[model samples]
Target chain A: DAMVIQNPRYQVTQFGKPVTLSCSQTLNHNVMYWYQQKSSQAPKLLFHYYDKDFNNEADTPDNFQSRRPNTSFCFLDIRSPGLGDAAMYLCATSTRGQGGGETQYFGPGTRLLVL
Target chain B: DQQVKQNSPSLSVQEGRISILNCDYTNSMFDYFLWYKKYPAEGPTFLISISSIKDKNEDGRFTVFLNKSAKHLSLHIVPSQPGDSAVYFCAAMTGGSQGNLIFGKGTKLSVKP
Candidate 1:
């Protein structure tokens, strides 16, 4: 079945170290997104790729970056991991159109722990 | 300010009963609303959605009602099952190219058998 997949469901990294989380989709959607979710908080949008164009949220920190090498793969790279950055990272995909109300399909998410 | 709001942090219901989850929004520009179900250690899955043009949409045992004038929407689950226990998140989107979803703090529902 077509679905979103994330690698390394749980990740541990030292503070100030760089880490990367991966996401791939079989749904062939045109849009891919990355979100950061802290405990008891709403999933905050970090960035997204509309096809090949990257769109970053205004409040997203500089430590977080995303790359979409192709339609099926996207990666989130944390330049400097911080204790506060430890949270569940989610990846989602959607086919743009239909008044921009397309339902986004999400992956299981990667839980990052910064030590 | 939160564009979408799910005031209830948690709810408890019995199996075979109706589970009602309510959501409200402060953004008048929001034209589409959706409900997502999330289990622990997993990503949220799309359950149901309603457009601003319509007041309600239903699929199987799940129904979503939208009150555009009041900026309120609700999800109703009939004959709620234990498997239905999860976090329900209310999300809203405006008609645009970005298609960014504004999510509310999720409500955790516990359906006891």
Candidate 2:
């Protein structure tokens, strides 16, 4: 079954400390996305990669960064964790075809807790 | 600045009745819409979708209606079952190669048996 997978379903990090949440996919999709979702809010796009070409949202903070080392793996690195950043991090993937109406498949999501 | 909005936070319906979830969007460039169902501790699963070219799209017991003029779209479920209870999210897509999606906050639906 081809699906997206995220590591450390629950993560705890100290304030100002660096934390990395990882995502991988067996779907071999051309596009991979990272979204931040707070309680009672919609998931916000942080960044995404299209076959290694990184596209960051204009409103995304500088503290957030991402790297797609290969086709199947992508990593989200928080330069310094903040209490306000505590939320669920979701990873999703989609193919490039279908004329921009592609369906995105999501992982279970990594719930981050900044102490 | 929410591009997509699901005004209702929650809704309840009796089993075997109809369930309607509505969503509105401010972006006119959005030409595609999708509805996703999510359970607690699980990722959202795609349920149904509609395109700007089409007014409605149906699948199984689920149907999606898109009204381009009003910038409103809705998901309709017939003969709702308890198993259908979950969070329903409405998402819209702009016409581009990226296929980035703007999503609503989501509406929690409870189907009582």
Candidate 3:
């Protein structure tokens, strides 16, 4: 019911292997975001898409990239997954309408375990 | 550097008591602050928020207080219940940014009934 969804609740990839995580939202919001969360740490912004306009965090590594092929789908691609990259990936969506900036709705994150 | 910081890693509260969660930030540029509650294996849900211009905001049993000078904010829950036990994260939004929130590590609250 109009919520964000992430595929493969859990993922496993070996060192140096490329991995892709997908996110989609039924909320039909114009803005979508990707965040990486390590255990017991804050969720860090990796990048975001505002209707296909990509905004990457200044501190985010180049190895991480995102593509929003369409309104409902956004993908996070890790060129070479490392053991250090193991963490939960979260997706969120929001719309900046009349009232201006609103709260973001997050999806149950995908826990990635790199082998 | 962590823009938002929840110094208290964990807290315990007695049932039906007031739960006060504190958050501090190093960035004076942050103009918006939010509180999110999360359960294990689940995503965080927005609880409440306060803008830098306002000193306080309230909803139902929850309230948020923002002190712009100190770069500190607080969330208060009255008559806390056991179900309130969960991880609470404090986040901040920089000026001119859309919905980008810099989050704190989180504080785990245990409400004992």
Ranking by lDDT: 1, 2, 3
lDDT of each: 0.94, 0.93, 0.91
**Residue A87, model 2: Cα distance from true site in angstroms:** 0.4
Error of 1 at B46 (Å): 0.7
What would the TM-scores of all predictions be? Answer: 0.98, 0.97, 0.96
Which candidate's TM-score is highest? 1
Give the range of the ten consecutive residues with the poorest summed lDDT in model 2 chain A.
A94-103
**Tens digit per residue, CA lDDT, model 2, B4-32:** 99999999999999999999999999988
Better candidate number, 1 or 2, judged by lDDT: 1
lDDT of 1: 0.94
Which pairs in model 3 have colliding backbones?
none
lDDT digits (tens) for residues A1-105 of candidate 3: 789999879999999999999999999999999999999999998889888789998989999999999999999999999899999999999886653346888
Per-residue lDDT of model 2, residues A1-115, tens digit only: 9899999899999999999999999999999999998998998889999997999999999999999999999999999999999999999998887575788889999999999
Candidate 1 structure quality by residue, lDDT tens digits, A65-87:
99999999999999999999999
Write model 1 residue lDDT over B1-113, tens digit each, in one string.
Answer: 88899999999999999999999999898888889999999999999998888998999999999998888999999989999999999999888838789999999999999
True contacts kept of 3: 0.67
- Determine the backbone clash count of candidate 3: 0
Off by over 4 Å in 2: none
